[model samples]
Target: GAGVSQSPSNKVTEKGKDVELRCDPISGHTALYWYRQSLGQGLEFLIYFQGNSAPDKSGLPSDRFSAERTGGSVSTLTIQRTQQEDSAVYLCASSLGVRNSPLHFGNGTRLTVT
Candidate 1:
């Protein structure tokens, strides 16, 4: 894809279900980031990956949220034991991993927990 791509544009799951969202970064990009936006709210950083360095997972709300990047290309975020509060649009972005690199974002996956 020419830009960051995310799968399953929308998802609906029951409370306590697990959900997995996938992202494919633009070719050759080394920085990937995950963010969540609640309805009419600002984006909240969830995680970040840059090259092979350790991912910055400090923004994850709890152990139930996890993410991994493979081969520095594709990434997946898994939400375990989903709650209603977890419902939000999950966005993925990629950049060149350089200072002041602009981020290209995916359309995001909207997850709704009932």
Candidate 2:
């Protein structure tokens, strides 16, 4: 895909279950990011991967949320022990990892926890 791609556009999971959301950035993009958007809210930054350096996970809401970028391309966000409060749209974005580079975004995966 030319733009960032996210899988399982919609997910329904039970409370206490685990969920893994995937993101594939454009080929050669050095920066990938994960964000979450709750209903009627703005995007919340989650994690960031820039090249071989350690990822910035400062934005993660809790210990249950984690993410990784392998080979500087594909990334995944895992939420353990899903809760109703975790329901949101997980958005993935990518850029050149340079200053002022525009990020390309995916439609996002809408997760619902029951």
Candidate 3:
């Protein structure tokens, strides 16, 4: 894909279930990011991956949330023991690098925890 791509555009899961969101960045983009937006809320940074460096997971709200990027191309976000508060649209974005470039965002994955 020429831009970021996210899968499972919509997901409905019971509370306590686990879910995984996938993202495929542009062919040569070296910077990738994951963010979450709750209803009526702003985007919250979740994690960031730049090249071969260790991903910055400080934005993750809990230990239950984790992410990883492989081959500097694909990334995945895993949420454990989902809660109602976890319901939100997960967005993935990519750029040539962290600076001097606009990010290309994917259609988010809308997650609903019942």
| Index of the highest-lDDT prediction | 1
lDDT of 2 by residue, 17-103 (tens): 999999999898999999999988899999999999999999999999999887778998999999999999999999999999999
TM-score of each: 0.97, 0.97, 0.96
Name the runs in model 3 displaced over 4 angstroms. none
lDDT of 3 by residue, 6-67 (tens): 99999999999999999999888999999999878899999999999998988999998999
- Minimum summed lDDT over a 10-residue window in model 3 is located at 1-10
Candidate 1 on 1-114: residue-level lDDT in tens? 598999999999999999999999999999999999998889999999999999999999999999999998999999999999999999999999999999999999999999
Model 1 RMSD in Å is 0.8
lDDT of each: 0.97, 0.94, 0.93
**Best prediction by TM-score:** 1
Between candidates 2 and 3, the lDDT winner: 2
Q: In every candidate, how many clashes are there?
A: 0, 0, 0
Which pairs of residues clash in candidate 3, taking residues 3 or more apart in a chain or in different chains? none
What TM-score does structure 2 among the candidates reach? Answer: 0.97
